[model samples]
Target chain A: MRARLLEATVELLVEKGFSGTTTTLVSERAGVSRGAQLHHFPTKNDLVVAAVAHLTERRGEELAERAAELPTGSQRTRAVIQMLGDHFAGPVFTAALELWVAARTDAALLEAVAPLERVLGRETHVMTVELLGADESQPGVRELIQATLDLVRGLGLASTLGDDTRRRRKILDQWALTLDVALDKEKQ
Target chain B: MRARLLEATVELLVEKGFSGTTTTLVSERAGVSRGAQLHHFPTKNDLVVAAVAHLTERRGEELAERAAELPTGSQRTRAVIQMLGDHFAGPVFTAALELWVAARTDAALLEAVAPLERVLGRETHVMTVELLGADESQPGVRELIQATLDLVRGLGLASTLGDDTRRRRKILDQWALTLDVALDKEKQ
Candidate 1:
C-alpha cells in the first residue's frame, strides 16, 4: 500500500507540480481510500516528503550501483559520470525540475528538497573524488571535475528547456574530451 | 489593459502552474473583462508566449545595459558574467524551469520555448564572443566561462532548496581566481 501510494505520488508530481499535487489526488490515483492515505501519511506534506525521500535515496543508490559494476579504471570513472547523467535524467529530472521550480517560493517544499540535494551532492562529490584521487593535486584536475559537474547540471537545464539536442550533445562530447585530456595530463 | 492582463498572467502563473493557470484565473486576477484578454491574446498560449517574450526581451536589454556600464578588462568580463547571472536568474529562472517541465508533454510549449531560448542563447553568446574575441582558443578560457555559468545555475538549483549564499559565493570567488589564471595564461 505504501509502495502503491509512492507510485501514485510520482505520477501526480510529473503531471501537475508539487503545489498542485495533493493527497486526495494521490489517493484517487492510487485507487485507495482517503483513510488509507491518512493511515500511511498523516499529512499531504508527509506523503510528498516521503515520496521525495524515497526517490532521492533510490536514485543515488542506483548510480552508485552502476558505478560499482564497472571495471576499476578510467572505465569506472566514465561509468560513474554516465551513471550521474542517467540517474538524475529525463523524466526523473523533470520531476526534480518541477519541484525545484516550486521550492523557490514554497518554504516547505524548499525544506523538503534540502536533504535530497545534499545526498545528491555527496554522491557526486564522493564519486568524483574516487575517480580523480590520483590526480588530486594536478593544477586543473580539481577545477575540471568541479566544472564538469557544472557542465552536466547546465546541460540538464538546457536539455529540459528545449535547447537543441544536437548542441547539447556537442557540448557533452566536448566536456568528455576535456575531462579525458585533463585526466590524461595528470598521468603524464 | 494588455499590461494589466500580463501582470495577472504572471500572478496566476506564480500561484498555479502552466496547467493550472487559466484565462478565467487571469481575468479574475486582473479584474479585466474576459473579452479584453481575448482582444489582446486570443488564447492562453498566446498570452503566455507574450509574457515570456516580454520578460526575455527585458532581460536582454538589461544585460546589454549592465555590460555597457562596467569598467574594461577583467572587471568587464566579471560584470558580463554577473549580467548573465542576473538575466536568466531568480524567480524568473523558476518560471523558466517550469517551461522546461511543461515542454516534455506539451508540444505547443516545446515549440514556444525554442525561439525564446534561442534569443536568450544568442544574447549571452554575443556578449561572451565580444569579451573573448581576441583569444577564445586559449585553453580553459571557454571552460572557465562555462564554469562560471554552471556555478551561477548551480546556485539557482542550490538556492531553490534553501539558503546557499555561502556555496554560491565560493563558486563565484573560484570563478574569479580561475578566470584570472586562465586569462593570464593566454597573455603569456
Candidate 2:
C-alpha cells in the first residue's frame, strides 16, 4: 500500500505538478483508501517529500542495475554516455524536475529535497567515473565527467519540450568521441 | 505600464512561480491600478504568456549586447562560453524555468510558450555558431556547438539548486578546451 501510494504520487507529480497533486488524487490513483492515505501521509508535503525520496532510491538502484551491464573497452565511454542520456530523459527525471522547480519557491520542499539531490548527484558522478574507468587524478578528466553529466542533463531538459532524440543522439555521440580523447579511453 | 506589468510578472514568476503569481500581485508590484492591469491582461494566462515573450526578446537583445562586447582571437571561445553560462544562470533563466516546469502540466501554456521557445532556441543556436566563429560546414562542428549550449544550460540547472559557480567554472573551462580542439580553432 505504501509503495502504491508513493508510485501514484510520482505519477501525479509528473502529470499535474506539485500544485495539482493532492492526497485525494494520489489515493484515487493508488486505489488506497483516503483514511489509509491520511494515516500514512498526514499532509501533501509529507506525501510528496516521501515520494521524492522513493524516486531517488529507485534512480540509484536503476543506475546500479544498468551499470552492472555496461560494456568494457573502447565502446565504454560512448555506452556510458548513452546510458546516462536515456536515464535523464526517462520518467524519473521529469518527475524530479517538477519537484525541483516547486522547491525553488517552497522552502520546506527545498530543505527536504536538497540533501538527497546532492547525494544522488555525487553518486552519479562517482559512478560515471567508475563506468568510464577514467582516472580523476588526471588533469581535465574530472571536469569531462562532470561535463558529460551536465550535457545529458541539458539534453534531458530539451526532451521535456519535445522529442529531441535525433539531435540528442548526435550531440551525445560527439561528446563520447571527445571524452575518448580527453580520457584516452581509446588507448585503454 | 505594460512594461512594468510584464516586468513584475517575470519577477514574481522567479520568486513565487506561476501558480503563486496573480494579476493582483503583478498590479501591486508594478504599482499599476487594477483597472489598468486588467485592461492590459484580462487573464493570468495572457499576462504570463506576454511576459514570457517579453522576456524572450530581452534575452535576445541581451545576447546581442553582450555578443558585441565579446573579445576576439584565442580567449573568444572561453569568453563566449562564459557569457552563455552567465546568461543561463541569471534571473531570466530562473523565470523561464518556472514556466517550463508549469507548462509541462499546462496544455494552454504549452500551446502559448512552445512557439516562442522554438524561435528563441533557433536564434540562440544561430548566435552560438556565429560567436564561436566555427565552420559548421565541417562535420561534427554543429554537434559541438549544440553540446556547448546543452552543457551551459545544464550548468544553469545545477546553479538553481545552490551556488555551483565554482564547479561550473571548472567544467566550462574544460569544455572550452575540448571545443577548441573539436572545432580546430587553435590551428586557425
Candidate 3:
C-alpha cells in the first residue's frame, strides 16, 4: 500500500508538478484510503520526501543493472552516455525535476531532497568512473569524467522541454570520440 | 515603471519560484500601483513571459560585452568557460529556471517560452563559437562547441541546488585543455 502510494506520488509529480499535486489526488491515484495515507504521511512534505527517496533507490538499481551489461572500453563509454540519456529522458528525471523546482521555494523539501541528491550524484559519478575504468588519480581524467557527466546532464535538461534526442545523440557521439582521444593520451 | 516591474518579476521568480510569484508581490516590490501593473500585463503569464524575454535580451548583451574582452586563442576558450560559469550562476539562469518549471504544466507559458528558449540557445551557441573562433564548417569543431555549452548548462543546473563552484571550475579548466587538444588535431 505504501509502495503504491509512493508510485502514485511519483506519477503525479511527473505529470502535474509540485503545485498541481495534491494529497487527495495521490490517494485517488493509488487507490488507498485517505485515512491510511494521512496516518502514514502526516504532511505533504512527508509523502513527497518519502516518494523521492523511493524513486531514487529504484532508479539507482536500474542504473546499476544497466551498467553491469557494458564491457569496459570506448564502447562502454558510448553505452554509458546512451544509458544516461535514457535515464534523463525518463520518469525518474521528471519526478526529480519536480522535486528540484519545489525545493527552490520550500525549505523543508530542500532539506529533504539535498542529501538524497548528493547521494545520487556521488553514486552516479562513481558508476561512471567504474564503467569507464577511469583512473581518478590521473589529473585530467577525473575532470574529464566529470565533464561528461555535466554534459549529459545539460542535454537531459534540454530533453525536458522537448525531443532533442537526435541532437543529443550527435553530441554524445562527438563527446565519446573526444573522450577516446583523452583516454588514449593517458595511456601514452 | 515597466522595467521596474519586470525586474521585480525576475527577483520574485528566483526567490519565490513560479507558484509564489504573484502580481501583488511584483507590484509591491516594484513600487508600482496594482492598476498600472495590470495595465501592462493583465495576466501573470503575460507578466512572467515578458520578464523572461526581457531578461534574455539583456543577458545576451551582457554576454557579448564579456566575450569582446577576451583575446582570441586558448585563453579565449578558458575565459568563455569561466564567463559561462558566471552566467549560469547568476540571475539569468535563476529566472529561466523558474519559467522552465512553470512551463512544464502550463501550455500557454510553454508556447510563450519555447521560441524564446530556442532563440536563447542558438544565440548562446553562436556566441561560444565566435568566442572560441571555432570553425563550424569543420567536422568535429561545431559538435565540440555544443558539448561545451551542454556541459556548462549541466553544471548550471547543479549550481541551482547549492555551491558546486570549485568542482565546476575544475571541470571548465579540464574541458578547456581537452578542447585545445581537439582543436590541435583539427589543424593537423
Candidate 4:
C-alpha cells in the first residue's frame, strides 16, 4: 500500500505538477483507502517529501545497476554522458523538477528537499567519476564533470518544452569529444 | 495599470509560484482596481503569460545593453558566460520557470507559451553567438554554445536550491577554457 501510494504520487507529480497534486488524488490513483493514506502521511508535504525521496532512491539504485553494464575504453565517456542525459530527461527527473520549483518558494519543502538533493547530487558525481575512469586529482576535471552534469540537466530542461533529441544527441556527442580532450583520453 | 499589474504578476510568481498566484493578489499588489485587471486580462493564463513575455523582453533588452560593455579578447568568454549565468539565476528566470512547469501539464498554457518560448530561445542563441564572436561555420561550435547556455541554466537550477556561486564560478571558468579550445581561440 505504501509503495503503491508513493508510485501514484510520483505519477501525479509528473502529470499535474506539485501545485496540482493532492493527497486525495494520490490516494485515488493508488486505490488505497483514505484512512490508510492518512495513517501513513498526514499532510501533503509529508506525503510528497516521502514520495520524492523514495522515487529518487529507486532511480539512483537503478542508475547504479545500469552503471555496472557500461562499456569500457574509448566508448565509455560518450556512453556515460549519454546515460546521464537519458536519466535526467526521464520521468523521475521531471517529477523532481516540479518539486524543485515548488521547493524554491516553500520553506518547509525546501528544507526537506535540499539535503536529499545534495546527497543525490553527490552520488551522481561519484558515479560519473567511476564510470568515466576520471582522475579528479587533475586540474579542472571535477568542475568539468560537474559542468557535464549541468549541461545534461539543462538539456533535460529544454526537452521539457519540446522534443529536443536530435539536437541533444549532437550536443552530447560534442561534449563527449570535449570531455575526452579534458581528460586526455585517446579519441575513438 | 496594465504595466503595474504585469509587474506585480511577475513579483508574485517569483514569490508564490503559478498555482499560488492569482489575479486577486496581482491586483492587490499592483494597487489597481479589480475591474481594471479584468479589462486588461480576462483570465489567469492571459495575465501570467503576458507578464512573462513582458519581463522576458525587458530582460533581453537589458542583456543586449550589458553585452555592449563586455571586454574584447581573453576576458570576453568568461564574461559572457557569467552574464548569462546571472540572467538565468535572476528573478525573471524564476518567474518563467514557474510557468514552464505549469505549462507542461496545462495544454492551454503550453500552446500559448510554446511559440513565445521558441522565439525567446532563438534570440538568446543568436545573442550568445554574437557575444562570443563564435563562428558557427566551425563544426561543433554551435552545439558548444548551446551546451554553454544549458550549463549555465542548469547551474541556475542548482542555485534555486542554494547559493551555488563558488562552485558555479569554477565550473564557468572551466567551461570558458573548454569553449576556448573548441572555438580555437586564445587561452585566457
Better of 1 and 3 by TM-score: 3
**Tens digits of per-residue lDDT for model 1 on A132-180?**
4536576555655665565567667666665555554444544554556
Off by over 4 Å in 2: none
How would you encode candidate 1's per-residue C-alpha lDDT over B1-188 as one tens digit per residue?
A: 87778777766665566667789998888889988888989888888777767766666676667666877755555555555555444656655655666665567867877777777666666567675443567654565455455556655655545545554544445455555554563332
TM-score of each prediction: 0.78, 0.97, 0.96, 0.97
- Candidates 2 and 4 compared by TM-score, better number: 4
Clashing pairs in 4: none
Consecutive 10-residue window with the lowest summed lDDT within model 2 chain B:
B179-188
Give the number of the best model, judged by DockQ.
4
Q: What CAPRI grade goes to candidate 3?
A: high
Worst ten in a row by lDDT for model 2 chain A: A179-188
Quote the positional error of residue A49 for candidate 1 in Å.
2.3
lDDT for residue A21 in candidate 3, whole number 0-100: 90
Deviation in angstroms for B106 in model 3?
Answer: 1.0
Model 1: how far is B60 from its true place, Å? 0.8
Q: By summed lDDT, which 10 consecutive residues of candidate 4 chain A come out lowest?
A: A179-188
Model 3 pairs whose backbones collide: none
lDDT of 4 by residue, A59-159 (tens): 88898888888888788898899999999999989989999999988999998888888888998999898888888999999999999999988999888
Kindly report which residue stretches of model 1 are placed more than 4 angstroms away from their true locations once superposed: A15-34, A70-79, A134-147, A162-166, A176-185, B11-33, B134-151, B176-188
